[model samples]
Target chain A: MTSRKLGGHFLSVMTVVIAIVVFFPIFWMVLTSFKTEADAFIYPPLVVFQPTLENYNIALAQSGYFRQLVNTLAITGFSTAVALLLGVPAAYTLAFHPTKRSNFTLMWIMSTRMLPPVGVIVPLYIIFQNLDLFDTHFGMILLYTAMNLPLVIWMMHSFLSDIPYEILEASQIDGVTLIQEFRYIIVPLALPGLMATILLCFIFTWNEFFLAFNLTITKAAPLSVFIASFKTSEGLFWAKMSAAATITALPVVIAGWVSQNSLVRGLTAGAVK
Target chain B: MSTLQNSVPTTGTARPPDKSYLRQKLARPAIIYLIVLTQIPVVFTLIYSFSNWNLLRPDRTRFVAFQNFVDFFTNPDMPVIIRNTLVFSLSIVLFSLIFGMMLALLLNRQFRGRGLARTLLITPFLIMPTVSAVMWKNMLFNPAFGLISSFLVSIGGPRIDWINTYPMFSIVVIVTWEWTPFMMLILLAGLQSLSQEYIEAAQIDGAGPIEIFLYIIVPHLRRYIEIGVLLEVLFVLNIFGEIFVTTTGGPAIDTTTLTFDIYKEAFLRWNIGRSSAYGVFAVILANIVTIVFLRITRSGTQQNKEAA
Candidate 1:
């Protein structure tokens, strides 16, 4: 009994230590966000300092930073909505009325995800430029939609498939039209899954850096690109950069925290099953 | 009309009622959109890989056969970039898996503040990659004013320019910090899903904790572990933001992965053809890894089912 008590105490201490280590950097970043430029750069890293909203004020006041924030919100929101609009119907079809070719189509959709974004990015860059879509909100939205559609379809498909067939069969026998069945039965039943898919898609689009960095120059630059602009001028503005980063990361971080369980499901969908 | 009606009845007798029309109509938009989105760029990439198209020298654009491929293979930096990619990806994946599993195991047991602990532990994975990289680069690893440097200096040790002195290792550390949370969450899910009856049975059979972990827990978590590693590999192989932010794949290309290499070729040097070839190589490599991963997981599930 004594040994078990000792073991329990040991595990608790270990858990706390591990948690602190994982959370420290994020804590430090947020703390630095409120520090003045002088305090932020001070060696021996002040544990307690006068906190201020100066950094946030400056970051938010900057037209560039504010624009990127709006851009990120718009792009992530519109793209996720568009992805679901296209993906949900397709997933419903594949889940319920799977034909001989349905499995093949599903696999093909997934394989498209395996194509390195860098591989297709070159052509996309050229095409976007040629079509005068470069650095435009519409272009970013289109690309993000394409990037997320497969995952959305796959996740929604898994979720919709889990709905009991009996319920759907009953609806079918009641002389419900296909559109009505989808609208009334499928949509309501799959609401939780749809929410999960939306959250996952939003998080992904919000955090995406590669294509956003490559495809946009100024007009459509999202938070990722905004933060990246700090990279070149990092030495000069450590405090403000930290501030910018904290602000840039806040939305997705909150989204991630709120929907972590659904995140795991979305991430490990096909792989787990 | 009579012949068609007869055929419909015969077909209904031969097979299940066909839902082709509805299914096709429903699936068509997504399928067509995805094909246009994915196929066009892939086809363009394929075609461009064979041409001599430098954005700088547009007049020199011509069909170059396998010249770009040959050049990319023979480049002096090719081997170094490949090695960096392997070491960077493998180190991150292996360490994250180990740390993740350990954390999952620790969190799995009943402990005080378990929910808060789990939330705190997952914070890093939630941060944007670029933001995470910046925080690490500026706040923690900055040689002069960063936390680590401050600690080192206070201990009377020399300051270390993390990115300049150890570029690849710095990248690996930053990436591992970001990704470990993801692995832990997935493994934690797997761990929680395990039946407690088996562990209780093992304990009653006088099996030690070590024995139970090795024999029972490891086998049960194998699928989750594989999933985590494969997914990590898929993402890690394509990591660009961290490297780009910290070292810019520099100090003489010490941290350049294949993705960064392609970015450099296309954007910096404007070597469109060579970049396309490199891109093709990356695609092939990624596909190979993905195919093997799928095969392993497929067979693993099949075996489990058969045993059941």
Candidate 2:
């Protein structure tokens, strides 16, 4: 009993050390955002300093943070939602049906993921401009959807694969249509995985800077481009930059915390063998 | 022929009214979306690559066949950019894999607080690339007041200019920080899945741990390593956030990789034609690499699984 108790105690103490390293950078960023501009760069830095909201005020008001927040939300939400609408059916097809083409299709989608987005970024950039989708949410949404669709399909397929074939067969025997089985039985079983996938896709979309930075000059710039507001012809505004960075990363951190368990499981879900 | 109506079973139970919509519910939405949304980008990108069109030139954009490709290959900066990109991506992949495997192996040893250590290691993976690059550049690696310099002085080491002095090395270090955990997570999974019976048997047969590792473990890890490397290489190829934030392809083109090159030509100079050429070239090169890797992996993956 003592040995078992000691093991538990050891793990708990280990958790404290982990909490330090894992939480430290974020802790420092948040802490630094509150420090005055002068205290921010001071050597042998003060752990404690007079907190101020002035940095956040500058970032939000003068930095155009609010519009960028909207752009990020729109693109992230729309793309994640749209990717699901396309990928769910594709996943359903692969799960219920079998053909030589099934494997090929899966491979094709995965192959797309393998290519660096840079490969197509310029073509997409020109395409966006020619089609008048430049600096537009719809344009960004479509591109981001494509960006994430393969992973989405892969996630859905892996999650769907875990459900026993018998459950679906039994549902069919009980008079459920293929679509019905997917709608009711399959979806409920895959809910946790679906949520995890959506959350992850959204985070990637939200965090993405290159596409958002290049594609949208002003109209559809996300938090990434918005964060660049602190950047200008002049040097970076450190306090204001930290404040913007802190604010932009807040959503992802909160979502990550909410789905920490599922995030881990979902990430490893696609690991074959 | 099948119906949701028939799916409710024959237990003398009443079927729901909505059971008849099965056949109507097809993947039309998905198919339409793929054709309309995805096909456009794919088709447009292909088309633009063939034309000598710059976005800024409204009326003078003209069709040019293979000129983009020719120009890309012959461009003054082409070789340098290609070399830098290859070096950056290859170095990141190599180090991340080697260090990741070693770390995974070490951390796999039953130790106190491994779980917490793991979470800390993976935290960088979840952090946005832009934020991570910025954080490292300013707070950790800045030559003037960064933690690296601060630590160096504390240890009687000299300060090094991470950006201008060693731009590529700086990028590699930060990327490794962010991606090594991804590799470790994968290798750890593969390691955990490797059964102990074989090792025990090998030990009984007079094999040492090192021999068992080389003979048994190395062969088994080949596929996982391939997969891990492939993923890392692919991500490194598209790395835009770090270059954008840290150095912006500076110090006289030292950090100018393919993606940054495309960005500079297209957005920075508004030269859509050349960038599209770069984009197409990117597609071809990426395809070649992936095809080769897959061929290599198809065999190794089977062996990898057998060991698992």
Candidate 3:
């Protein structure tokens, strides 16, 4: 019994140490974000330094940071909104109305996600250039909406399906319309799941890079692009890069933390539960 | 009210005619939207893959038939690119899974500040991939003044320039760091779902901790492990941002994956036909994985239904 107690204590301490080691880089980045330029790249990597917001100031001032921030916000917000707008209704239909094609439809929607963006990017780039959608908010939003729609549909479908069909049947009457059923009954029931879906969608779109980098240049480049610009800085701008990276990553990190519980459900498509 | 009377079901079935109509209406927009924005582009890609086209030499464009694909398969660098991609993705997935499971098991135990620990652990995954790459490259992996260098010197070790010396390994480390939390989260969910009675029963039957874990826990986590691995494969196979930001596909094509190869061929080389051919292969690989993933998930769900 005593040995078991000792073992448990040992494991707990080990857990704490490993967690710190794993989390150190992010902590160091946030820490470095506040350090002076010279102090940021010291030989011993200073843990104790005069914290300064100079890096943040420099980072924010350079590279159209404000524009990128706005673009990121706009793109993430609209794409997530549109995905939910389209996904929720479709998910509702699939969950409640079991038509012959419902299973096929769900699979087809998911298959769209599996169509790697790289496969279509070349053609899409050409099309975007020809159609004047290459570097616009509308273009990014359109792409992100498609990127997020399958996720939204799958998550919302699972969430909606979990709400017992008995409740809907219990509430239904002869003359009630489908919209009324959705507006009053399903909406209230699925609100929590909807929030999770929205948060996940927002996070994915906010942090997305591949398409964002390839598709947009200057006019609509989001924060991901902003962060990528510091890639080849060759360690000269460590502090500024940290500050810029911190700014770009913080919101999504917080959102992910907040929705961590539901995140598994969304990510696994409710497979685990 | 009178029109409602006509629409309302007065027969044996309680279902309304308009409800199914509305359901179909609800489903159409998303399907149509996806077809227009996502599927149409792929069709165009297929068409472009067969034609010889270069943005730089537009006048020279013509039907290339199988030439582009032939070039892709026979390219001298094809083997190296394929090897780099396999090594990069497999190492990240395998290492992250091992470490993630260990962390998950540890976190599953009762401990102080477990929530905080989990939160801190998961933060890496939430950071933008670009940010993660730059942070690793500039702050941690730098040979001169990096934390790793500082620590190595203090410990009487050689200071290693991680990115330049071991480009593929460095990328795998960064990506694995970002992905470990993902695996942990799913595995932890699986662990939490395990019934306490099963463990107690094993203990009562004289099973040691390792034996119990090996016998009981591994089997229980098989489905979760499968789901996690498949999902990781789906994402990690197309890893780009970290590679792009860190090595730009290498010091000299050392780190180029199929996705990056396509990107370079199309954008840098202006060889659209060749890139589109590469793109087609990427699509096929993704679809193959997706089909298997869908099968497993479907069967798993069926098992869940049976168990429930």
Q: Highest DockQ, which number?
A: 3
Candidate 2 CAPRI assessment class: acceptable
Model 3, total clashes: 0
lDDT of 3 by residue, B1-308 (tens): 79766765444355656765776668789999999988899898889999889999999999989898899889999999999989888898899999999999999988888998899889999999999998998888988877888899899999899999999999999999999999999999999999989999999999999999999999999989998998898899888899999999988999999889999999999899989999999999998988888898899878878999
Q: Candidate 2: count the clashes.
A: 5
Cα lDDT for residue B119, candidate 3: 91
- Which residues of candidate 1, in runs, are more than 4 Å off? B1-20, B297-308
Residue A185, candidate 1: alpha-carbon lDDT? 84
Clash pairs for candidate 2: A174-B7, A174-B8, A175-B6, A175-B7, A176-B7
State the lDDT of candidate 1 residue by residue for B60-116, as single tens digits.
Answer: 899999999998879999999989989999999999999998999999988778888
Using TM-score as the measure, the top candidate is 3
lDDT over C-alpha atoms for residue A84 of model 1: 91
lDDT tens string, model 3, A206-267?
Answer: 99999988899989999998888888788897888888889999999999999999999988
Candidate 2: where are CA atoms >4 Å away?
A1-27, A50-63, A177-180, A229-236, A254-269, B1-28, B35-39, B56-60, B154-156, B201-209, B292-308
Total backbone clashes of candidate 1, pairs 3 or more residues apart or in separate chains: 0
Per-residue lDDT, model 1, residue A35, is 88
Q: B106, model 2: CA deviation in Å?
A: 3.1
TM-score of each: 0.94, 0.85, 0.95
What tens-digit string does per-residue lDDT give for candidate 2 at A1-273?
A: 999778666655554564465457667777888988788777666787889999998778854578888888989999998889878777866766645676666666666666566656766666677889999999999888877787787788878887887887777668765555667887899998888889888777888888788789887888887665432312245566678788888788667655554554444336543
lDDT score of model 1? 0.86
Residues A5-43, candidate 1, lDDT per residue (tens digit)?
998889989898889977998888788888888888776
